[model samples]
Structure formats: C-alpha cells, structure tokens
Target: MSQTPGDPRHALPIRLNVDDSDSPADVVDALFLGRFANGEQPYSHSTSIERVKPGATLLPPAAEVVRAARDSDRSATLAQGEGWTLLVSRWSRGADVTVTAVSDELAEKVLREAVDGAQDEPEPQPENVTMGFWYVSPRRGPHRTTRQIAAGTWAEVRPNYTAPVAEAMDRLMKTTPDDIAGRLLLLHGPPGTGKTSALRTLARSWRDWCQVDCVLDPERLFNDVGYLMDIAIGEDEGTAKGRWRLLLLEDCDELIRGEARHTAGQALSRLLNLTDGLLGQGRNVLVGVTTNEDLERLHPAVVRPGRCLARIEVGRLTHRESVEWLGTEEGVSREGATLAELFALRRGSGPASVPAQHDGADAGLYL
Candidate 1:
C-alpha cells in the first residue's frame, strides 16, 4: 500500500447523478469518465478489509466496487474528496473502486451524499433470509460488473433428493467457514439432479456467515487470469466477518475432468491452488464447484480424500423420494425424477415442457 500526501492530482470531486438502476460502477464511471477497474487492492496489506462496511444506503453494485478494491493485495488511490478518498487498485483477480475516510461518519456522508444528483432511495431490507446473486461480466469478465438477483429463502427451493443427501446438504448449510477442514466443496452428480437447486439453498442458508458469489464462467475461471484472480481474491465488501467468502462454480466438468491436466494445463492447477494451496491460505474463502462428471472421472488431485470439505454426489431422487416430493402416490412412476423434472411437473407441465428459462428465473441462481 502506497500513501502519498493525498496529492492534488488525485483529488476528484464527485458529481453523482444516478437512480436506483445505476450501480456504483456507473457512478464511478460517470465521474471518472470511464469504467472503474474491478478486483484491485487499494489499501495497505495490513488495512483490514473486514472492518470496511458499506453505508446502509450504498447500492449493492457500488458495494461490490468497494469490496473488490479492499480485497486486493496492492493499493492505488485514484482520487480524494473533502472527507473521502477514492482508490482504484488491481488484484490478481480484478480491480475496483474504494472510498476511504478519516472517520466512519465522513465515510457514510461521502458514500450517501451525491452532489448534482438525485438521491436514490435504499431498497427495503428483507426481514429474514435474503440471498444475493452475482455473475461474471460477459464482455469484461466476473470482476467488472454484477447485479443482485431476487431475494429467496430455502423454503422456495424444491429439489427432491434422498433423505440422507437432503440431510447432508442441510448440515453443510449450517456449517460455517470455521467448521470446514478444507477450503473446497465439490458437488457432483448427473445433470438436472438438483445440484444447482441445493446450492441456492446453501447460499441462502449461509448468507449470514459468508458472502456467496458465483463464477458465471466456471469454464473460464481457471483459464482466464483475470477471472480467476477476481473470484479468488475479491472478498465480499458487505461482510463484517473478516475474510469469509464462498465462490460458486457450476457445470465445470470440462475444467476438472480427468484429462484436464493434460489438456487444460494450468487451469486445473489454479483451481487446486484456490482450493487449499498457497492462494487459499489466510483468506477465509471457500470454493464450491458443481460438475456433471462422475467422481471417479475428476482429476485425482480434486477428488483426493483430504482435499475437500465435502464431496457429495447429488443423484436423482429415488422412487419413494420422488413420490413424496411430487405428492403423487400413483401418478408418477417409481423410477424417480430430477429436480428440474419435478419443477416442471409442479408447474402442471410435462418434463419435456420445461421452458428454456434463464438460469436464475426458475432455479433462483441468477440474481
């Protein structure tokens, strides 16, 4: 972390003109005249990001910008205001904006006040069980842009699984970062077997203890330096719980397949590093990966017994489990059904009638 005498060259007066739809990135871009970098560390290494909290009025998108900056291993202050200073730094994962002030009051004032702009009212906070969704930017990668999905609770998820599997998932949800022995969580099974649905419930249940952010392009996560850096280092700015984060990487069979080391090269190694190697050390981050590949087919390093906190296979529900889930003793056969199929049936539609819905709309993964 470099600290200059708050040089005048870096002082930027804010001119905020945003509404509810605008993100903090938009605000920074509007003021800085370009995109604000994401995944940058703009604070001293000793500067504990855990203590940094966004004002209650700060929008989710803007909160992410600040979080990315503080999570970085380096520092770069871009501008300074009367009571606050703006930082733009790069992390191995991404870069982002940060506002630092001499006092919490000044920080809140600088965060909430928007000169030359209308005040965007804060969205009402939910009473209980709030879940947030984030995705990688298609054009710029995961660190660049993010949006919140609709809030949901575990009650909304209807994934049908065997009793033991369901109970295991519930236990995992209740487990905190402190309880896990390893940093990686591997959820694998056949497609449409409720892998994603169960992940949603886990995210909702663990919201209080950890910040769950998804890597939209899991295939690119290890291959792309920026994407990997962003997800691995970008701590959730909203969390006051020190360094707790959960990274969700779904449908990444190609990245962790048996032949990945021979084909994907460093991708597999990078994923492993994020799991429990040097990169994962000292960061209270957990990596959750979902794949359709069989457990035996995953890279040996990935499936090694001690390498994972939990290695659960999300198979399709059994005949009895499906009957209980569907509430049809005779209508549905005992062959069982996947969560997707059950969802389709619940909608009064056949399995084939499952609409080509986007990821989050039906499954609650996309916010």
Candidate 2:
C-alpha cells in the first residue's frame, strides 16, 4: 500500500511487524506513545488497528508491541489501531493514497468497501471501532514542529476537587489576555514540591483558551535563554496575542555561571529581557520558569518584581499534608519519611537509605 507522504510526527522509533504472507508493501502506518512531540501532529488521515484489543489507539510508545498475521488470501488487512503520523518506508502491493477523514465506523466502513469490494463476504463484527487516526495519509512539508519540552503533560493528580495548584492557576487564567503578553511567571521550589506538576496542570487545563503551547525542554538549553526566545518568535500565533505560547523553563539555577554581568550572565539577563522588554510587549508569550533557586540571589534584572510577574514557592507539605498522604489508601504513607520525602520515595523505583543523625538531629527522611 502506498502511504500518502507526510512529515514524521515523532522521530522516535516504532516497530510494526508484517508476516511473510503479508507484503511488506502494506507495511505502512506507525503508532507512537502519547502525542508525539507533545501532540504536535505532522501528517493527516486514516485510523489504525491495535496490538492487543481489536481496536484502540496506542497511547503509549511502550505498547508498540505485537505483529500482524499475514493471511494468504491477499485481502487488505484491517486498519491497525490509531496512527501517530509517523514516517515509515517499505514495499507493498495495494495502493490507496488519499488523506480522507471519516468517523470511527464510517472510516472502517469506507476502507472495508475499498479493500473488500467483491473479494470476500464482509463480517459485521461490532467489536471494531472506526475513527480518524490523524495520519495514515502523509503530507509534504517541513517535519512537524518539534516539541520544546517546556511543560510536561498534565496527569490527573486528584479527582473531584481541583488540586491546590488550581488556585494559583486561577490567578494566571484570570489575568486579562493582554496582561499575559511577554510576562514571566515563575513557579519555583524544593524538589517534589509540585512546582513542575502544577505548571503541567495549568498549561493543559488552559490549552483550549490559549492559542499554542510550547515547552522549553531543559535538554535544549545547550546554551543561552536567548535561544529559547527565538523559539517563541517562530511559533505560529494561531489566535491573537500570538497564540499563548507558554515557555516552561526549568533548571533556572543552572543558567547562572561566571560572575554576575559576565558574558554568559548577560546572556541569561538577555533571556529575562526578551520576556519583559519591548520584544515581549505584545508577543502574547507567558513564560513559566520553574527552578529550585533562591530568588534573592538571581540577577536583580531577572528577579525584579514584574520580570517574573508572579513568583510562588511550592514549599514542603505541612504535618496535616503528611497525614493526608499517609492516611490515603493509594498514596504512600509517611512511615519512612516526611510527607514530602515519602511522596518522592514512592515515585522512585531505586532503593532508598536513611542516613544517620547529624547534629543530634535524627530527623531526615525519618522525620
């Protein structure tokens, strides 16, 4: 089957198996983990088949297991699970290459008609779901805009009650869209204090109201924050105020090197300037930088009042917080550490050790 050409959504590897009877040519389409490059879809068209169940979109890359059973009859195979708009190359016989859109069943219905017409009696199995899988057909263009991991995807931390972070996010959202233009919003704190977690939730919840979302991965900062700003410039502003492209800059402390005002330091300063200066005035950019740094030591320019318009510290959970976590059925209890430490420990897989007391302070993770 000739796949319609399009840019790859994820450069990450995806393995699809085609048995001997099945022509490698029909071996098109790929299933990726979650939204590749964070849902920045590159191609368009056609749903895919599944690995385990007869039908379901493969949401995680880890589930990219299993293979196709090649029957001898030469009938078109069912569309595999959902497509992640990946790029794949192989040889095959069938050729249906047009990026068309259809409902879950209607889509499979059309494919069923196209491939099985006059070939075999169609089985009406209700188990299969037919839905558009963004990219079975491809497109010609630059690769999908790569993801800048400024913010991570939001996970449901709690149900029913909006998490505490929502209070802070409420403030962020209530801001007049105009107020968000070129402003820096910092969420900083000790590790496991939920700074990053909170930001993830904020961005995801606000996605509908915002134009575009871009995360600034720490890995990308091979250099200056200036490079980060350049990303904001290039991203499309699908809606006004240049779609809300929130740059999630983590690891703020790592940026400060050399004496303050040195070349690198100035570069760092420029990063802050880019957000707060004329460049930021109407760009419609809201930078949410999370760091474990002491704000006072940060360059006055970067740490100034309006530079990072709002500075909120996600501190240690209180004693009551500890009880809440420990008393919970699913969460780890505060047996080995404080509520904060226990939370981190549970999230980790490696074995943990409790160090001996210091200054007669037996209180460490044990506390």
Top-lDDT structure, candidate number:
1
Q: Each candidate: what lDDT?
A: 0.60, 0.43
Per-residue lDDT of candidate 2, residues 125-152 (tens digit) = 3322111111112222111122222333
RMSD of 2: 14.3
The ten-residue window of minimal lDDT in model 1 covers 43-52
lDDT of 1 by residue, 27-134 (tens): 444444322211122222112121123332222223333322132244332454543455454333233434555566654555444221322224544523333344
The Cα error of candidate 1 at residue 346, in Å, is: 2.6
Rate residue 133 of model 1 by lDDT: 40
Lowest-lDDT window of 10 residues in candidate 2?
A: 128-137
TM-score of 1: 0.63
